[model samples]
Target: RRQFLITRIYAPKAWWFGFCSSVYSIAGLWAGAALAIYAAMIEHKNVAVF
Candidate 1:
């Protein structure tokens, strides 16, 4: 009975870990894309100002 309970608790934890990792990966991708776009915009502005 104790073993079953432990397994049940761990099962959800494993799933949660996977879910969190996927979310983190997606967020990192979005941040990288935003940074690239911002860099491009700054470059364009600098050229225009000069």
Candidate 2:
């Protein structure tokens, strides 16, 4: 049927879009955490030196 064909075409696109967005969000969170930890470490070192 025409509806079935249309659903098949769009389903994968929707799934792929969701998958990519989730991956991007996860990577962004990881990068943010890493930057926070690095900044804290640098601050700690500076405090100890002074």
Candidate 3:
């Protein structure tokens, strides 16, 4: 949300709660369909949630 500058009020209209991660290699979704969410360390990196 920070990266996209999305507000809490905008969340319901902008994003959904049910969508989860998909394998890029296997799912083959569009470029704007997925967003990364960081887990632990910065080096460990984020998970793609669609």
Candidate 4:
């Protein structure tokens, strides 16, 4: 019974870690995409000015 209790707690912690990591990865991807778009827009404006 003691071991089962420990296992139950550990399982949820592991699941939470997996969920958090996935969210982190998705956020990173979104930030990277936004940065790229902003950079492209700036370059476009610079080209037009030249």
C-alpha RMSD by candidate, in order: 6.8, 6.4, 14.8, 6.6
**Per-model TM-score on C-alpha atoms:** 0.66, 0.66, 0.16, 0.66
lDDT of 3 by residue, 1-21 (tens): 485555545676443442333
Give one digit per residue, the lDDT tens place, for model 2 in 1-50: 99867876879887678789999999999999997888777987665433
lDDT, candidate 4, 1-50, per-residue tens: 99867866879887678789999999999999997888777987665433
lDDT of 4: 0.82
In the range 1-50, model 1's lDDT, one tens digit per residue, is 99867866879887678789999999999999997888787987666433
Better of 3 and 4 by lDDT: 4
The TM-score measured for candidate 2 stands at 0.66
Model 4 misplaced regions, further than 4 Å: 1-10, 44-50
How many pairs of residues collide in model 2?
Answer: 0
lDDT of each: 0.81, 0.82, 0.42, 0.82
Which sections of candidate 1 miss by over 4 Å?
1-10, 44-50
